[model samples]
Target: MGLAHVHWLLAGIDEIAAFRLVFRDDRTTDVRGTGRLVWHGRTLVWTPGGPYAHLRYTVAINRQRPPGTHFDSYATPDWIATRALHLFPEINVRFRTGVAAARARLRFRLPRGWHSATALAALPDGTYLVEEPGKRFDRPRGWLLLGRIARYRHTIAGLEVTVAVAPGSPLDVRGLFRLYGKTIPLLVGILGAPPPRLLIVSAPDPMWHGGLSGEDSFFVHGRIPIRSPDKTCSYLHELFHVWQPFHPSADGRWVSEGLAEYYSLALPYRAGRLSPQTFVRGLALFERYGRWGSDLTRTRVPAALNNSAPLVMHWLDHEIRRVTDGHRCLDDAVRSLAHEGGTLTTASFLRAINQAAGRDFTPLFRRHVYRGEPPPERAREDDAGVGH
Candidate 1:
């Protein structure tokens, strides 16, 4: 096995309070140029004596754990997750270097019979490059899986998509691939293209309950039945994130998340995976849940508010269609945002809607989304089509 060398370049560090190195393992040896190391629990309080420091450490891959719902940086025997590789404190420092640009790369010492998957692009020499422009240290950008994994490959939208599952996992890999095969086309149609490569990892842990999405990859809790409606929707929701626009302001989170929820059902229905009746039933569930108490504009919208967000989106779609005389819809607005990528805010969302409909929707947004007013009642004619 090759030794893994993790490197970091530190800039503008002049004091002890400016930085600290945290590691789960305190016995980290071969440390160079990090002055006055003090061990406080699992944290290394490094008092750097220089303005710039080059830190490198050799990490050992030890015991492996079964895939679980939560994420951590520690290595497991059969599988190695990204948290295990990039979890060191030096890479995690956010206070001083939060806004600075940073780049990272990992050289894994893969044992025989082990393979790896990550969002980072792999080099010819087997090194993985992780580059972030506006360094958001707190965000978990690095996700990896190394082990005796079962990889299923498919070509969709001119992209090579690979689904990697841990060996002995209970997840139904075939079912997952089938769902992706059907759903990905619809997603690509909406977004205008596919990522060059998509990697999905399924880790089964009875303890983990939800899924998470990263840069070009995502994780699904394997405990959920593969064909279950909830699991299917959850999987689609995470997949939608890969194509969704990034919104720095928290206010526009409703737009991003609500659209994901809206399409999680709509795409399946459009793809014939869901019957019209089932799709309407799903929307009805959202409407019922949306009536529960919560405000949409709050920085942290409650889960109940999130449950109702799709209803508002549906209403917005209907309004857009009505104003445009069927020439435009919500999809156009979303596509516009996807085409013009940046920090998405409520203003940008409104602009997209106005551009698509050729009319301003500020009043409608102010009433329903911004003010947290109750969603409009379902139209009687719409219900008849849905068989309600």
Candidate 2:
């Protein structure tokens, strides 16, 4: 069967009022595209060649519905997709795909004081490779083709990448590697060893946003939010969701959001970039913002999309750690759920905790989580968000 596809055409920045997208395919004898355009951000479009000349775009695609199958969850982002795109400020787009691969060709109609470069590097496996091409800032102010090549592998997702610098302005191969080195491991740990495919594009100005759009794997818009290290962490969190292996089936905000939150802390902690105490303090801080203290066990996990619920669960995690001597906690519960094949319920969660603690968690869970009451006043002082 042929893969489903979507096309995206971005013309401007800030508010994308007339953002037009077409979902199409040529698998059948007749080639056609179908999709929708929603009023995005908060901007309007007039003349396409106005200040909107400089733009970035992305297309994301994946398998169709088959609940709990790996296909649906594959909707996450890939790192390489937007890595080079974001580094350069250029645009002009066209697309093509073949039996084994897909490609996006973007051009720089006008040089924005930079050089465009391209490179092709072989992968360790030799069969798979990567081609990274984009504009590199030049001292003399001109265009230099910058790109990299790697052996083509099973998929074009989270593969380790190396890029060639075109007589740089500031960024060099080593510097890029530094960023990649820090980025890939976290990507692998959270998403998997192989990163998902993502599309990165550079904008004339900084915007700092990333997400999945149709036909686009993962779109990272604007200049890299250098100051916001959290953005990259957040990217990994969302992009990895494509590998979730299930869909329409509730993954619980507590599971999804908590995992994202936990990983945001866990990765940095493991890297020695964050102190354990500091991490705990962060959790404590999050506890302060919680608007929930529901009896999770009795509430059936709510199945709601409220973001606050996970913060409440985070507090519960803190309580579980406190009561279970830290040896038995949400980490254990998560692992247990993952072991049980990625489907978790409040009931299953309670059972896991009780099993780990070697005791009944009913009374404890009831008093702390199921009831709307606070966890405990003693545990609430410093974490002002939680009024236990």
Among all windows of 10 consecutive residues in model 2, the one with the lowest summed lDDT is 135-144
lDDT of 1 by residue, 213-331 (tens): 77777777667664445313767777788756565367777777788877887777777777767776677677655643455655364454446777777788888877888788888
The estimated TM-scores of all candidates read 0.75, 0.43
Candidate 2's residue-wise lDDT over 1-388, tens digit each?
Answer: 1122222233322222222322232111212222222322322122233223332333232333333432221212111122232232222222222222223233433224433322233244422233332411111111112222122122233463322222211223243344445645654543434523432222211122333321123322323342233322433344445333322234243445545544554455555555545555555544454445554333433222122344445555666777777776555655555556455555666687677666777776565455644444344343333333
Q: Which candidate is the best by lDDT?
A: 1
* lDDT against the true structure, each candidate: 0.66, 0.37
Identify the runs in model 2 with alpha carbons over 4 angstroms from their true place: 1-232, 239-248, 276-281, 293-326, 362-388
For candidate 2, the C-alpha RMSD (Å) to the true structure equals: 15.0
Q: How does model 1 fare in lDDT?
A: 0.66
Give lDDT: candidate 2, residue 199.
Answer: 26
